[model samples]
Target: MNLHVIDTGFFKLDGGAMFGVVPKSLWNKRHPADENNMCTWAMRCLLIEDGDKLVLIDTGMGDKQSEKFFSFYYLQDTITLEQSLAKKGFHPDDITDVVLTHLHFDHCGGAVSLNASKGNFYPTFKNATYWSNSHHWEWAMYPNAREKASFLKDNFECLESSGQLKHLDVSDWIGNGPFPWMNILFVNGHTDKQMIPIIKYKEKQIVFTADLLPSIHHIPVAWVMAYDTRPLITLEERQRFLPEAVSNEYYLFLEHDAHHEMCTLKDSEKGVVLDKTLSLDEL
Candidate 1:
């Protein structure tokens, strides 16, 4: 199996929102903010090429939103989803499975796109089966007031309408192997039943830390996002997960960090902290 880092692009978001209640004095030192206090973050995605299946973990925000809508986030960067896939010698059609960690716009917007001529929404990966658990699907479909803006209907409804949406049973997530070579870790703190793919690769375990651990700076137990509905629940989930990640030496694949691509954790006096930083190719 071969793994590739599909860097969709970068976008800006309020650092305060990203760091939650964490003081700016602390987070500012980590990811410095611009004059407007917006911190740039990468919309990094992962691709796993295993035999006949080319699985994409998450799709970054697509370029379908209006200029006025996108101006809010200040999206930047030259690389795009199509270009990133093409660099790996694959196309959207080559993706057999799309594992959506959740239905957040930044995480799944690229899954569906607008067809200009037809004036219709369609799955970007025309042949891939888009995967999301029933619980998260329902959560997104009928989004709560807090998360409604992030859960855009256009980003996901087309997948279901196109007859390409598949629901994974949350109950089947038992033992170490839920989906052949990978196990899933579910946490409801960030969003209900958000699935984090724990992939086994080359004698090492690589975790796709989708929002649960957005960046290496978020390794601390208290660095939960403001976007999360239950901050205390997120803190508790991190307390449980970080120790295991440190003990087992898991290579965390960050989805939103701009500076650091992947990182390992170590047990420091202050708890689990970043041990080393490297790219996917270095791993």
Candidate 2:
């Protein structure tokens, strides 16, 4: 199996929102913020080349939203998803599967795109089957007031309209997914049922640490996003998942951490801390 990092570039979000409850003095050391109190984040996706299945995991926020909508996030250092794929010698047409970690605008927005001919939105990956669970889909469709801003209908509604959307069994949410070389670990703290993909490659496991651990700085159980629906649940989920990550030495593929690509965990005296940061090629 082959793996590649798909860079959709960076955007700015309020640093306070990214690191909830944690003081700026603490998190600022790890992730510095600008005068606007915003920190830059990467929308790094992953590409899996396993046999005939060329799977793209989590497309970043696409450029379909209006300028007014984008002004809020302050997008920068951008490249289209197509350009990222092409750099890796592929294209959107080459993708056969798309696993949306969840339908938050940042994670799944690129899953759909504007169809200029029809003057409507459609699946960006025209040839790929978009994966999202039923529970999460329902949650995104009828998002709570707190999360409604993050769940844009234009980002994903067209998957169902195009008949390419599929949900994994709810039973498969915890462990052992239908995918031959991957497992699913669902954590509800971030949203209803955010799916974190655990992939096996070259006898090692790579955990796509969606929002469960957005960045290495989020290793501490207390350092969760303010945007989470249930911060307490996020703490519980992290507490449960970190030890195993240390024991198994899972390589964490961070989606939002602009600086670090992959990292391992170690049980430190204080808690589970980052062991080492390495490029995917190092694996």
Candidate 3:
């Protein structure tokens, strides 16, 4: 099996929103913000080459949105998804599977693209089967007022329209491998049924910490994001997952961390903290 770190690009978000109720003095020391109080973050995706299957974890925010929409997020250091795939010696057509952590615009935007000539939206990965659990799919489709803005229809509706969307059954596995060599950890705090992939690789368990743990700074129990629907549930999820990650010595693959690529957990007097940081190649 082979894993590739597909860096789609970077974007800036309000530091306050990212760190929730945590004081700026605290999180600012770790993830220093700019004059605008915005912190830069990476839209890092993962590509898995396991035998015949080529699975992509998430697609960063795409270029289909209007300039007005993008101005709000301050998207920068941009790299197109297609360009990133080409760098890996592959193309959108090469992907066999796409596992979206959730339907948030930044995470799944690149999953679909505009067919400009046709005046319609279409799946970017023409031959790939897009995977999203039914619960999250429904949540995204009929989004609540708070999250409605993030669930862009153009980013995901095309998958279902193209007859390529597949839903995973959450009950099939508790903590076991659900997709060949990867296990699915269903989390609800960030959004209903956000799926985090726990991949078994080379004698180590590498977990894709989607939005549950956006960056190393988020390893602390109280650093939950303000964007989460249920902050308390996110706290409970982190408390439960971190200890297990520490015990198993799992390598956490961060999705939104701008500088850090990956890190292992260590049990400290305070709680579980980052052990060591390394890139995916170092794994």
Per-residue CA lDDT of candidate 1, range 106-216, in tens?
A: 999899999889999999998898888899999999999999999999999978878999887666766623258878889999999999999999999999999999998
Q: How high a TM-score does candidate 3 get?
A: 0.97
* lDDT per residue (tens digit) for residues 69-107 in model 2: 989999874787889999999978889999999999999
lDDT over C-alpha atoms for residue 173 of model 1: 60
Candidate 3 shows a clash count of 0
User: Candidate 2: global Cα-lDDT?
Assistant: 0.91
Of models 1 and 2, which has the larger lDDT? 1
For residues 1-283, what per-residue lDDT tens digits would candidate 3 score against the true structure? 9999998889999999999999999999999999999999999999999988999999999999999998988888467789999999998999999999999999999999997888899899999999888999999999999999999998998799799998886876555333668889999999999999999899899999999999999999999999999999999999999999989889999999999999999988998988999999998
Predicted structure 1: lDDT? 0.92
What overall lDDT goes with each candidate model?
Answer: 0.92, 0.91, 0.92
- Each model's TM-score, in the order given? 0.97, 0.97, 0.97
Error in Å for residue 154 of model 3? 1.0
Which one wins by lDDT: 2 or 3?
3
